[model samples]
Target: MQHIIDMISNGTKMNESEHDELINEVSAELVELYEIEYDPDNLIPADDETANRILEAAFDLLEAVGVYSVDTKSVFTIPRDEIFRSVQNSQRYLNIGEGSDKYLLTLAGSSEKKKTSIMGGPNASPVTPEMFIPIHRSYAKYTDIDSIAPAYLDVPAGSAKKGPANLMKARQAVQLVKEACALEGRPDMCITTPPHIEDPVAAVSVANPRFMGSGDLQEIIPQQGLKVNYSELSRVYHYKMTGSNYLCSPMLVRGLSAATPEQFAIEIAAEALKSQVVYGASVFFKYPAHIHTGDPLKTLWASFAATQALSKNEICLQGSVVTSSAGPCTEMMFYETAVQTIGYVVCGCDILSGPVSNNGSITNQVSGLDAHFMAEVSRFASDLSLKDANYLCNELFSRYESKLNAPEIGKPFVDCYDMNTIEPTQEYWKLYETVIADIYYILQQKNRRISRR
Candidate 1:
């Protein structure tokens, strides 16, 4: 109640300040008061008590700080009662995809165990028109990857076309994704639409029910200052009407938003929880912003705290893996990918796998191989308890810790795979095997010995 009053008073002060100034100010101030309780000895915090404490910290941050609306130019005052009501109305089960391809995505917490589905594709990365089909084909063939969101839209790449024409380009992305899935015999796949398209009406105009159907998920991202803008608001409305899902991803960059780990985690929770409270969106994701796939320490800390907070309170899910300076087909790339994805799975996230090579800069820099590697790492990492998961993260981090700055951006998909055959070259497979073998050894060292084994 005091924080709500404070936010109102702060809102008056905001008028005297610029937008970016207020944003930068809140981001810097929010996490400064909280000290990180993350143990160096136990990085993942295996105890249930620790997770609960993290949840408590997150709620306090949410109630005290609340969310800022760039559009309204005022802070959103949280009526505690209404926020709780929205949480009570939070969704527990979600049906993704259409027809026989549909899957009931059940949300779970860090304490409860459930198989996290593999949501694969380019995400929103840019790719050349020629490579889109072949790249998506890579993910579609894998049974482990349940849904697809093809990256690198060929339609809107490098002025090859005119204005964003959001609807036209979006339709092309959908049409192209269908082609890729069809080649892999998975025409009934669920995929994501780019948020660049601002108008929900235009998006619906392009989404032909006969092909696009009603099962697709679109991203609804709030502005950096935690404000829900018209673009995301309309998309939420579109989902409410269509009965589709929106992947609410509020990425809190380490340096940009929060200076420290504690602040970063709190910001993530504030965004995720607010998304649910405001929009009734259940599928939430927290991706740490870094060029080199981010660090395991950062990933585990922020993801564990925020996601544990969400899970404790609502029928919600949080997710994994984003942003890498490292490109595909290099040994260094696999090592970084292995460490980061493993950390996210162990920290507990609904895994969304893909190597956004070159920090999602260039197309053909990503391949099906990158997505495959992410899936494998996340699946293997999920098997370990938090204690062993932490050990594995520390060990793997030791290998790539030095390479975080200016990571080796290796060759893109064209160099690594046989486009016609849609398979990895022998050289790539050999490197992949070697990386997996080393990771296995790391996991083995951490795993307690069984008397029988």
Candidate 2:
């Protein structure tokens, strides 16, 4: 870990333009080296050859360009040999929570029959202090979710992004999640994430053992397409120094930073490699979001390719979240979640981290019910073959592909769920049941076809 810190402080210095140029140049070279091609039809490949090629491509990218340090204006390069050694020596499983609630989260593979652990919350969605406890309590009350990520307090009095005020709010958010978990009779439930605070002091301060439990997972998010800033790096350093568990999250944009699907896959694999070699994190979570189209298929395709690569080659635990274009109470939202969840699980993800409704845009637009569905789908897909899982994804994607662009904004939490009872309203419940039934019907049909074959 000290080696990582040293590299962060003292690495090859480069300007932003030079960094970008390096990425573009190396990425282009890797595409040719690997003979990478985008297949819109086979979003999730079942074979080992594709996965191996992607893993190798990622290694080449790391050896060629290294990770750019946005804070130090430098690049940290790891030798290919060291990168392989780190991955070979990486941790394969993480034990989270405590006592009876404790869960063993291991690396998932396309062929593995193990159920992935579910992490639920609003995913740092906006919530007033008043709504924070009740909203989180609702999520904790669900028996299916293995962990929780609480919503950030969108305080009305002051800015929630800086200074002592932000620190106070960040601490408050962490305490509120603990309180909510205790209230729901699951005090040991693994809590994930502090509030999305920007102040480095506040961010690092909230991750201490006094506030965050040892079993809980903190986060270190690099910027899109293999860039790490000081703020996130400091948080990871704090967690490591304090002996806490942390997850490395990296996002890849489909066309913006990644340029193409092949590039997107390469970047995610590279980030996953860096998570172990540089960040020293055991769990890696990454997602790809499309820049132009609201359709998540392209994003899902790129992510599935990358995750399959990592799942096959690395020992570290891996996962991705279910982030839909539409908000809750819409069929599109459920459809999107099913597709994303199935893709991630079948391609090899150890944890199911979300159902970030409304693309995590609007405040109070998330629900425990959607997260519940994500968990259920994850468990169901755990035993499925990659071909069957791909079939289900294709079926669900066809249902809502056209609706992606004009997704319904839907209602906020107050309108769809009863805060007093901490349960979804009758209308929302009906939608939930209807969507579940529709999916089961598709699965039933799929099974029938398989039997006939």
Candidate 3:
């Protein structure tokens, strides 16, 4: 924490342009210098050598460019030696939740014996107060799901996310998730910290043993393109003192600072390495995305490549988030979730988080069904080799490629799920079954295709 403070107080100052220029220049050079590669034909390619190369390039990028402090207008660079030592000594296994609901999160390899930890929920979808408990209970009821990543509570009718309302809402969000878990007979279920309030003070205040639980996962998010602020730095200190499990969640937009999938993967790996060393992040949440769309193929490929690199190098426990373009209750969403889930699990990510429908934009547009299907796919993909996983994802992508641009934004949670039973309606269930069967058929054909080869 003091080192972080020192970085802010004494680091060399640079304007936004200079910082971006340096990032761009260093990123371009690293890509060429390391011969970073991405196979568009085979998104989830079985290439460990390339994966290891990407990880090395990521470390080089960090040592050269460092992390930019948005608030301080300064750059905080760590030496390669320190980065290596920090990663070597960082936490690898994390125990979250308690008793019956407890689950282990470890930096898993691509072994058939490993079980991918599942964190299921609406995943930050906006929701009214009336729908919060029911939506979360639907996920908490699942025995396969290890943790709950609840939806964001929509601001009270006319109020904004500030003042006492913000603090109250933050506390309320945690309590509501706990209530949902208890209702489902899983009181010890791991509950992730929600964005009830954007203010760091209220966020931090509600994040205690009482609200979010010491065993729950809290996220310290970095700003886009390797940037950090005072708020996140403070949370790192607080979580450490409270002995809470936390993840360093970083977002990479493909076209923002990173020009291509290869660049994006490098940036993602660099951020993961830096976060593990700097924040002592118990886990790393990897989500590479396009700024405006949902479930872009290139973004998903980038996520797999980065995760493969990190997992291969044994950086930290990595969690994969599946943000779908389509909404719940649609056939397209089922396909989207399956493809993303397969890629992530094949890449050896330890945790599978989401299938957050509608790109996580629409209010009440997500359902437990999406989470359930994602879990199913993740479990099934655990035993799949990279070759099989690649064939399956490519086949699924081919079916949905044309519909990627204008996927159907299906019904809200209320429409597709029976609130009384907290289960999917018959129509939604049938669609899920149909998609599952179709995916299996595609896998069967993969066998024939391989034999023909």
Using lDDT as the measure, the top candidate is 3
Clash count, predicted structure 1: 4
Query: Across residues 1-453, which tens digit of lDDT does each residue of candidate 2 receive?
Result: 667767778789988778777777788778888888877778788678888888888889888887788878888878899998888877777889987789988765556677778899888678777778888887899989999977867777547577888888888889998999999999999988774666888877877778887788887667765677766767777777888888887666765555667887887888888888877786888856442264355667778888889877655788786687788888888888888888888787888777787777787788888899898888888877788888888998898877766887888888888877889999988988898898889889988988999
What's the lDDT for candidate 3? 0.82
TM-score for each model? 0.87, 0.94, 0.96
User: Sorted by lDDT, highest first, which candidate order results?
Assistant: 3, 2, 1
Residue-wise lDDT of candidate 3 within 255-357, one digit each (tens)?
A: 6777777787888898888887778888888766552264466677777888888887788788877887888888888888888889888888898887788
Pairs of colliding residues, candidate 1: 125-152, 126-152, 127-152, 291-325
For residue 215, model 3's alpha carbon misses the true position, in angstroms, by 1.8
User: Tens-digit lDDT track for model 1 on 1-453?
Assistant: 234334544663244135445445554454444444556566566666555555555556556555665545566556666666666677777777766678777766655666767787777677777887888888888777778766856554354233446556777777888888878877787876643454566555544575466677766655544555555666676667776667777655665645556666666776766777766775776656563444547545666666656665543666664556677777777876776676566656665646567777776677777777777877787777777777776787677668777677788777888878989899888988888899898776555464336
lDDT of 1 at 333: 75
